[model samples]
Target: MTLGSRLTALPAVMMTPVAALMLATLVVLAPGLALACEDLTNRTQTAYKAGDLATLKDTFAAAEANADCSAETLQWMGKAIVSTVLRSVHEDVSQGGSLQAHETALREARPYGQDWRLEAWLGDIAFERGDFTEAATAFQDALNTLNDEELTPTAPDTAVIEEVYNKAEMARLAAADYVSAPTTRSGEPGGLAAPSYRGFQPAARLVPVEFQFGSTLVTPKGLRALRDLRDALRASGTQSITLVGHTDPVGGMAANDRLSLARAESVAASLRNEGYTGQIYVVGRGERDPLQWVAPLTQHQYHQALRRVEVRQ
Candidate 1:
């Protein structure tokens, strides 16, 4: 059916007064412009159905430039554009594309008014980049919005809300730790890696060092604690220290393994910079050894506790 006939066939409830006013304005502007808008909208619908992101992007932009398009038509085009961009971002992440590379695309979709989804994507980008403070703020903004279903229609509403909430809480904890306390030294059960060594104790004592999620750098407070350890080891004449790195079970096993080991290496480097001459052994167990293992639903709550480097002397 032609676009005009389809419009006329739509139920009255489907046509808002704003949409009707837009149609009247389109008619007054120029019949040819209205026809052009209809043609562009048709092309957009076809591209969206075919999952032709390139064509959908082109047609959406064309429609946006033409005021002859009805409000309803533009709204549909906006949804299509945002959906296409979101799918592309997911694809990029699956293929190991840098998160920063697709951040601009998500930001560009902001004009489409899917604030919840756009903010959620921005939060993910910040989280992956190790900017926990920004991530927490973005996730909080997403939580304040009420239309996550508009973006992730396939996922269960409760699951989506829970996931976003967990991420936000995790980010908030990491951000808070970064600002106030960088070193966590306690006999906390979930904090220990429980290395294989049997009762291996040295004269010097070292504790597990907490790290920000997806990060490998030693924090300033952690550096200070390591300096103290270095001085104690020197006094005790300790010959070697074991550093075991760990992460929460959030990402793929292989990636988590690499990240865990990277965290240990970062600590070792910091110790070396502090002039600790003792031998250093580093191990990356990844998520294989969690001080406390919880279900995926509650994993984020323990993420900060899990992402740590154990210093055994």
Candidate 2:
């Protein structure tokens, strides 16, 4: 029988909307398992970005419940996880968390296949992490995958081909033979790499935290932000934090310096209480390095911006 004949012979009960599109070439048509898996591809990326592990767990279960552990699901699942991990690594490096976050993602998704976008990201991650050879190889693999008619559903456009070629050539400049890099520590448990660092612009304020004026107290809102920052830093294997405090040009300039140091110490104490054993370095730049240079029209705006400790991981 011809390809059309086989599709036509499929029972009505087994027909999905996807299966009906005979002329289309997407390999996403099947029963309950395949459908859930299809939905999972996007949902997993969303949940990872939101820092909602609970939601990720739910999505994983929904996709797996009806899944037959097929090759397609495995490939897409690996792709989703790779995306999550790449986001984490970049976010870490950008946020001063740690650049090492890319290792497990690279090791985990490599077995899936020569997925173009995934390999492209893998190349960038390796390049940024100083693994030039892997970067070259992965980018080359991406270019090859994009060129392969059998592997890709459609040939990549000229623009895409040019972009991939540019990235690959850049990698080749620094490329050389090197040993395969190790994955994350063998004893470390595998879990979602976090904070969905895609389009992640760290808040303009100091570590997205705020402090009460004159007192060493952190506001409730500040506490929540600090906890999130602390967790991500620790999870990234960061071993130390530096807290730099600043104060508005209020009261005696000298006195403000003392107060600022006190505030930094207060925040440091809170992190210690939370079981962060790493060294906490505190510095006070009272009215010295004002974030708001122009005298604010109002006192509230001036003090609010200055009265905080910035976190450096």
Candidate 3:
């Protein structure tokens, strides 16, 4: 069955409202390295054509373990593995195939190749299991990949793309709301924060803070999302919070640096308004730091993920 068909076919209990539509829009949407892996090409190609998900999974895992597979070969195997997963998402997740297991498989396959389709599936499964934070990130990852292609004049599925974008954005907001949900209500601290610049010291964490495009104005919705972060500070007795600003590689370096810093300042201001009395530290990395960097910058979605303020807590 197609991805959309598979989604709709899922039991009501397993599918989210956004899950159905989010995957439906993806209807229109690899090689490896190894010499001892000479047989790798034939085996992966055969499994892909035959829709053998089990074999694809085994082959990918083995290939990865062998340490001899070329990037091209592993990437091909990764695509095949993803295809099998999509073809069998429902069965895999419903029949003793835990969401975590499938998610783990996809995560392993991701470095081999990253694309809109894989990320969309990742988002779909995450949403299925109520991991909205992960769902939001995966969906945004897919949207950014899609948007990167949209920069081309001949981009197809423009309408379908927008539908997907709306749903993805909605998922993200839902995630933010979940994060903002009181600890008393959520029964836990916020889900793992959005990814931050890797090279940042003391590790990078993010609040659900968002800013308007090309402007430092924090959205009203974004302002509301800071409650969880504020509460976390209170709970931890953390005396200070650090805010690091980052931007997508859309504009000049100097301009992005300034914009990123400005964006962080905006969030800092919002935090104070939200009753965060701690010493707030702010700095901007500009385009120097991105959560995920895709080339050509035409891929606005990837850039979108990069453009944000992160909290070092």
For model 2, how does the per-residue alpha-carbon lDDT over 1-313 read when each residue is reduced to its tens digit? 2223322322221122112222233233334445435666566556655645456556655666754456666555544444454444444544444333555655665664445655765665676655666776777666555545555555544555554455454444333322121122332211111221122222221443456777777766567656755665676676877888777787888898998898888888888898888888998888788652221124574466567777665
Q: For every model shown, what is its TM-score relative to the native structure?
A: 0.41, 0.37, 0.42
Quality of model 2 by C-alpha lDDT: 0.54
The clash tally of candidate 1 reads 0
Point to the candidate with the largest lDDT: 1
The worst-scoring run of ten residues by lDDT in candidate 1 lies at: 188-197
The weakest ten consecutive residues by lDDT in model 3 span 193-202
lDDT of 1 by residue, 1-313 (tens): 2223322322222212222322232222223336758788678767755667778778877777888777767766777766666656555554555546878888887776554556766876777656776776677566544223343333324445455555664565455343211211232111111121122222322243667678886555455445655655565576888888888888899999999999989888877887888899999999997552212224464676677776666
Ranking by TM-score: 3, 1, 2
Off by over 4 Å in 1: 1-36, 50-54, 96-98, 115-117, 146-157, 173-313
Number of clashing residue pairs, candidate 2:
0
**Residue pairs with backbone atoms closer than 3 Å in model 1 (clashes):** none
